[model samples]
Target: MAGEEFEYEYLYKALAKYANEHQYPLAQQAYEGAGAAEKIHAAILKEAANVKTYEGTTVYVCPICGYVMAGDSIPERCPVCGGPERQYEKF
Candidate 1:
């Protein structure tokens, strides 16, 4: 999971750089979405390792975008896509 997180981070940075250099707004937005998801994944891994547990938890992922939230409930709106909470699917 940590390795995956680093991969995502690398992808996010590379995409962001390319987007900026090419003035691709869509790609820039995708970088933001990817970054958000990667941060959440990294945090989840760190927390699980610290507590030595991974039970009775939920991870919500926005279908419209890659926004990820770990908790019992989803956010009111996806920070990246502005998708409604109901749009999030459990992962």
Candidate 2:
């Protein structure tokens, strides 16, 4: 799963770079947003390797950049994208 996440992160970053070179602002932002999620996913997987079991937890995902948080409530803004807490989705 970590390998897959890293692969996706690389793909998104490459797409973002290409979009930027082509002057496609929206496409670039979209790819970058996806990349943020993939980046977080890889990190989470790496750290989760120490865990032996999973339990109930509320997970939040930032809509703008796909940032993630595991808690009872979300932060005022996404640390990665600065998206508002209201914009985050429960997962």
The candidate that wins on TM-score is: 1
Candidate 1 lands at a TM-score of: 0.74
Candidate 2 root-mean-square deviation in Å: 2.9
Q: Mind giving the per-residue lDDT tens digits that candidate 1 earns over 25-54?
A: 888888877777777777777777788665
lDDT of 2 by residue, 6-82 (tens): 65757888999999999999999878877776777777777678777546767788877767787686679887677
Every model: Cα RMSD to truth: 2.4, 2.9
Overall lDDT per candidate, in order of appearance = 0.78, 0.78
**TM-score against native, each model:** 0.74, 0.69
What's model 1's lDDT at 15? 86
Model 2 stretches astray by more than 4 angstroms: 54-58, 63-65, 71-74, 80-82, 87-91
Prediction 1 global C-alpha lDDT: 0.78
